[model samples]
Target: MYKNSIKILGAYGTKAKGFGTTSFMLNRHTVIDAGNLLDALAEDSLHIENIYLTHSHLDHISDIAYIIDNYFCKRSKTLNIIGLPQTIQALKEHFLNDIIWPDFSKIPLENSDVIAVKYSELYLNEEYHLDKQTTLTPVRTDHTVPSCGYIYKVNNAGVLITADTFSLENIINTVNNDMQIKSLVVECSFSSNMQTLAEVSKHLTPKLLFQALKKLKRDDITLYINHIKPSCLEEISTEIEAFRGNFKPIILKDGDFITF
Candidate 1:
């Protein structure tokens, strides 16, 4: 059961033959992103009540439409889509616009009073408690768009999740300032040779990733890598091993669990 641990529903940067995109199940009802919810949880996905988005990128939101499409009739509650103000605007104006996908925020659920989806704009750096024990704080991140990652704290320990960031400036400062952070989910989406592409896309290659991590003051934190573009997985993995310096990172897979 993933009652205490954060379950990685999808891990890769983009879809491949077998891999899915970004999604993390924090508990039965709370999730981080909507990249692969339907495929990962199937009918169990119906239990998901809130989807906290990092950004409005397609790879991170592909399943938001499918989850509603598949379970609209069975859903007993509204799907609360939470994110930064800009993130919510993108979802509403572009992603869930009637042409792209049905604006579920306006559509009521079958035989229910609640709408199919509800979008909540979260303030960056404010701590929101999912329950008495779990608190999620959205922090700024460097991406092509206005994106932000989260600091998930439970039982006083936390994990910093950098969903699709290019620069580690904001993340490093947050981690150093917060005593609760014990681990990190950093994305390395390209290989060292693809530096130009990585920067342009606001992603990271192993060389850039590790070079930035050197500034982190806390050396005891466990590093977990995710969001790797499948095509360059092998090359990036090899580069991570070569340049990781002192932090031996565990490369995350779709079914992985991150226990804080």
Candidate 2:
């Protein structure tokens, strides 16, 4: 069997040095989030057909504005925006409304097909089929807003992306319950010193993240860390390196790809 690789279109914690925000273009056409995607992809941005959003945060949904405007002429089909009900409602009421941005769902394409930005509600822990060989399940997480972590299965390999979570119980249970889960991408958004702000913002500092991971039973998972705040990259990296555990977390930078 051929291994499917995941490409990182944008992975910086912040938009420093002309780098975009945290957006992952999975397997070319499918995107997990849209932060900086329009800035990252430029003219070829019309190829994206599906976006599985984790939440309604600005950093996660910012590029939806540009993608609709810049590629409306080139898009041949509807762009499916898949997420939870709250996520969909939030985007519709706040971001994609005509006041903030044009309602692309009603806009007509050249071929008479309207630009479709429809929402599909994903239930907790239930696996939804994306294609013949790919499935994704949404696991609820403790964020300031309604958020979820994704369990993406492709070609028999499972990768869990804990998107902007602060809860330990959900993470522990998901890790212990899913045996097929081989790789993980978790967020550590702040240093240990920023614990108060991190908790208030419902984000995870290195201290909080490690304490949460202590509940997990797995000892043999390839852990990848992401979402480190740009201001605290130095402190966060040092804190993460000092972590003593069975699995050492790998921090991701801009344009890093992973194959498992």
Taking the tens digit of each residue's C-alpha lDDT, what string does model 2 give over 42-119? 776888888988999987888888887777777787888989889999988998889999887677777546655766
What's the TM-score of every candidate structure? Answer: 0.98, 0.94
| lDDT (C-alpha) at residue 157 in model 2 | 80
Clashing pairs in 1: none
Which candidate leads in lDDT? 1
lDDT of each: 0.92, 0.79
C-alpha positional error of residue 235 in candidate 1 after TM-score superposition, expressed in Å: 0.8
Residue 192 in candidate 1, Cα distance off native in Å: 0.9
**Each candidate: how many clashes?**
0, 0
Worst 10 residues of 1 by lDDT: 1-10
lDDT of 2 at 160: 84
Q: State candidate 1's TM-score.
A: 0.98
State model 2's lDDT: 0.79
lDDT of 1 by residue, 1-260 (tens): 74558999999999987798999999899899988888789889999999999999999988999998889889989999999999999999998999999999899998689899998999999999999988999999999999999999888899999999999999999999988899999999999998999989999999999899988999889999999999999998889999988888999999899998
